[model samples]
Target: MSNDRREPATDADERTMLEGWLDYHRQTLAHKCAGLTDAQLRTASVAPSTLSLMGLVRHMAEVERSWFRRVLVGEDAPPIYYSDADPDGEFRLTEADTWAEAYATWQAEIDTARRHAADLALDDPSTGRHRRTGEVFSLRWILTHMIEEYARHNGHADLLRECLDGATGE
Candidate 1:
């Protein structure tokens, strides 16, 4: 099939535009790991940080699960990649945590997020509480926050990919 990165369409409505950009950022992260081996994906090429391509994949999967399944859909979905004991577990991958599993889980989370967001209104409130303040949020806020989150992490992924092998672009 086609190996093209999807650019967010500018002419769409607010919700559609948000989804498009979010999807674009998601695909952009995957693009950074294109043609790389699992070791390459797991390598913390940028020293002094625990960031890696594989870790990003896993982290974003958890992010998708948290916002869409747990918050937006009101499903009470539990954490997937991290725990209370090790909150950054998603960023720490062992040899056993292969890239295949990371990518598959990330894709599955993305699929689930899309399905959950499909029928929901932007003004809907989430079922989850804020970690620091015990506050609820709207679906609009979740979508906006997710886009910002992906954008930030994708920036890290961009640098990590560059340090690993110089691959770039969304």
Candidate 2:
């Protein structure tokens, strides 16, 4: 697979191009999460931050579900990470017993997010309110947010993974 990260042109087909960028980032994050031991997956290498590979996988799962299902669709869906419970629950993975389980969760969330993005018309704006602050946002804004969030997190993952092992991005 090519390591180059330049997104496909947006002018060709805006929706496809946007989705491609999102999918590329999702894959990049997964690539960083792959090939690790249980201990390494759970290790908090970034001091004071409990951001492990497993935790990031869980967090991404919540992010995909919450954004694609709840926010974009405006469904009366329960928040994936927190629902008046604990805010930090997204990063907390008590049941990430095995690496396989964690990866499966991440993959399932990714599939759902992809389907949600595919089902939308690029011109149609999303109609969900932000969980906090009660602010409403459009699909374009959400997609851009997701792309930015993943890009930033993937950069962090690059350094974290490199420190965990000598591996760098392809």
Candidate 3:
């Protein structure tokens, strides 16, 4: 996906606006990593920081699964990357982690998330409760939160890509 982000329609309804911006940010992350080799994808931003393009992909996959499948759909979905023993496992790359696998997983999670939210109303409350607050969130809240999550991470991706190859843009 190139950095040709779709401008969210200013006159669109709330749902369309949220989904549009979310997809824009999603594509932004992918565009940042495009044309990079596995080694480049795994290259960390700086010493003592495990953040990398590949790690962001894996982390987003987990985030998608957690919010859409586990929380929205109320599925007993488990973490695909991290665990209780290593809460940041997605960011902690291993020799076994491959770009192909992480990319596929991230795409799959995005697809699943779209499906889960496609038929739900914005005010529909999630079946699952927040892990910390024990409060159920509406679909609207989840969508807004997901947008914020992607936008924040995409900023990091922007800098990482620039550092990696001197490439920079919205």
Query: What are the TM-scores, per candidate, against the unseen true structure?
Result: 0.91, 0.84, 0.96
Candidate 2: residue 91 Cα off by (Å): 2.1
Comparing 1 and 2 on lDDT, the stronger one = 1
**lDDT-superior candidate, 1 or 3:** 3
Q: Write the per-residue lDDT of candidate 2 for residues 1-170, one digit (tens) a residue.
A: 23545666757576667777887888888788677787777777657887777777777788887787777777775655555578777565554466787688778877877777676776566677667777766667777888898888888788778889878864
Q: lDDT of each model, Cα atoms only?
A: 0.84, 0.74, 0.92
After TM-score superposition, what is the CA distance of residue 136 in candidate 3 from its true location, in Å? 0.4
lDDT of 1 by residue, 70-91 (tens): 7676687778888999999998
Q: Which pairs clash in model 3?
A: none
Deviation (Å) of 64 in candidate 1: 0.8
Q: Name the top TM-score candidate.
A: 3
What residue runs in model 3 are displaced by over 4 Å at the alpha carbon?
Answer: none
Worst 10 residues of 1 by lDDT: 1-10
Model 2: pairs clashing at backbone N, Cα or C within 3 Å? none
In order, what is each prediction's RMSD in angstroms?
Answer: 2.0, 2.7, 1.2
For model 3, state the Cα shift of residue 5 in Å.
1.9
State, as a TM-score between 0 and 1, how close model 3 is to the true structure: 0.96
Full candidate order by lDDT, most accurate first = 3, 1, 2
